[model samples]
Target: MMMKKGFLLKQILWISALIFMFGCGSEEQFEQTASGLEYKFHIKNDSARPVQLYDIVEVRMNYGTHDSVLFASGNQTIPFQIDPIYEGDLLEGIMLMHLGDSATFVIDTEDFFVKMMQSPQIPDYADGEDKLYFDLKVVNIITETPAVKARRLEATERKLAEEKTIADYVEENNITVAPTESGLYFIPITEGNGSKVKNGDAVKVHYTGSLLDGTVYYSSFDRGMPITFVAGSGEMLAGWEEAILMMKPGGKARWIVPSSLAYGSYEREGVKAYSPLIFDVELIEIVD
Candidate 1:
């Protein structure tokens, strides 16, 4: 089968753009951290406040390989907690900085995509010896250390915190939409004219899943592709199964999944037990 010229052109342009974005950094002046990650400080601040664990830091970040620019968040300030989810994660890069500091980090490409992004498989473009680069500038930092917040690890405390967290978020964000019976907020951001998703239908979707605090756990965009799966299959979280059923091809929505409908009591390297999650999904199509 012949590929369409327009699609082929887009693919070529995407590849070119990916390859053109990152700088071939010099190893000189780079310092190695205990975790095997290397970093170079472009701009450093000595007197400003330093980031601590659980602190919510706002930073301008763009990450990619020396050849490919994967995800460049444009001029946007992203706020996330300073907890390390995986070895050599974004946390490691942020921890070694103070307010107003700008730095570039060199980390293992496979470790980042496999451990941090939780990508099913590494993208072919990022599967080589070139390391991943993360350029970040600290904009703001709120010191919310576990001790400062008096956090507890008990499941009972977690249950209460989970409910309050959702409630506070909804109230502050002015989210007036009601949630489903399972406490899943199934709100559509855009409408779709295509066929509605059915149980056995094969569908492809682009989604970014994060914790309630803007910490992205997974993003298909970062992977430079979408994910395909059969609807209602147990491959997805329970919240996704219910939310995707309400969407159609071309539709986009946000789902606020409570811990009850999410990974309740399921802890892992990158996941916390009974953690609430948010998924921003774009249903691409219902496969033929």
Candidate 2:
């Protein structure tokens, strides 16, 4: 009987060992940095060249809580210059990876939360026990020279000034408008009479887009043809899509689009980098 009891105990111990080796021990696959950041390589390309400080790198990233994806840059990669002076685990992990490498970074929730406190999109239910995970792929690396760096810095400064101008205009005008969660502000000029515009609907609109100082950049009237496009098709700026969806046929409204929702830091045609745009738009019709 004692022998049988001993045999049963050994069997239990063996099963527990197997479970630990195959399941809970999976965390051991990840390597820890000196700062306690953990990362595991999903794909490693040892032959690919690595990047140095100040090198511009294009990376595709998906970031979220362990259980849910909050944001993802699908297909479109983001370009950023590596700044060794910047302090963050994400940057630290990225610096360790080479082009063509894909890795998952695990960051402490408390640290991530503190860093992300300024962003309103963070869910209220987030807790310190939870971890933030980032899946990153280094796509491309570009060497930055002194002239290129100077140009980039000038553009960045211009963008910051433009944003400040927009904020000052908003305050001085005492503009009372409905602000979207994404920083767009809409002031209804005239309510529409028909159904509200929705995603997948074909809509025609006449618009006059201008800078915050009321400098007209583009006008559909000047082209003599109203612009027509599928709503929410991503064919237009993010601010335009958000505002159009709220309007009905025959609606007229003024929209204040922040630069982040507009051309970002890119200068396109008449729009400059970080320009907050003002649009006076009339939703003429909604077809389909």
Candidate 3:
């Protein structure tokens, strides 16, 4: 009887160990889609509606390899129409999610690398064997209509006109400053010492921004604090971003930004719609 009791206790312990292992493994399991993409939802709102074709959806996405973050949208949400049917494992996973859903998708890096190689330059982090991951949240969905399309087209046309105005101004004034590849025009007043600013470096800048007619809109000097942000992070205007990357610490420059690169068609408190902007900027330091 004593031997039989000991044997039963051993059997129970073995079964418990098996159950524990299976539970731990299951925690990491993700649902695989027909396209072979694997995904798991971290947050789901079943009551929220799923986006349909022709709907404009806003999403925040972070895409990278398992070990590193290559790119992120930060606090900004990108809006896109769902009509074109984008081809990718990430898009496929996104289609499965409803509004307010947050999910992580795992895609085969081999396929991604193949598509990326079609570009002129392959990124340094591209690895064929590594799995790419996308963490995305569907923020909102708007049904597109004819009015929305018309308004967008109108905005585009206005923006083009504003760009032409800036070009004409540059020509008439004989501004000898040339534009960068990204279309930012800058005149370096004083060359700063030290290393040139690069992407991903946190930098401090003192700037005074105004309209083309020399109407001052904002000045960092008035605030008594220099503005600091990660370079090339889209936290500032596109023209400012391009100019800052070209400067070193203590460099002073004047940037003439077209409407498209400045504020587009959006009018802020002191900025008018379709207005070209000028900024007198001084790079204070490269924090990192």
Can you give the lDDT of residue 54 in candidate 3? 51
Tens digit per residue, CA lDDT, model 2, 1-288: 101112211211110100111122256788988777788877787788887776888887776665666555667665666753225556677888888888777866655533322111223445434676777788888899898788678767867686577678888999876478888989999998978998889998899989888899888878877888777554566677688988999999999988767666545567665678899999999975
In order of listing, the candidates' clash counts read 0, 0, 0
Off by over 4 Å in 3: 1-132, 135-140, 144-151, 191-203, 210-217, 229-241, 248-250, 258-277, 285-288
In candidate 2, position 159 carries an lDDT of 73
Per-residue lDDT over 20-123 for candidate 3, one digit per residue giving the tens place of the 0 to 100 score: 11112342577887667788787798889997765778887776665566556666665665532235545567678899888777766655433321111223
Predictions: Cα RMSD each: 12.8, 15.4, 15.6
TM agreement with the true structure for every prediction: 0.49, 0.53, 0.50
**Full-model lDDT for every candidate:** 0.69, 0.68, 0.65
lDDT value, residue 178 of candidate 3: 75
Q: Which regions of candidate 1 fall more than 4 Å away from where they truly are?
A: 1-24, 124-130, 145-288
Clash count, candidate 2:
0
State which candidate has the highest TM-score: 2
Query: How do all the candidates rank in terms of TM-score, highest first?
Result: 2, 3, 1
Question: Which candidate do you rate higher for TM-score, 1 or 2?
Answer: 2
When summed lDDT is taken over every stretch of 10 residues in candidate 2, the lowest stretch is: 12-21
Residue 202 displacement in candidate 1 (angstroms): 6.0
lDDT of 1 by residue, 102-146 (tens): 887787876664445433234555666558777778888886766
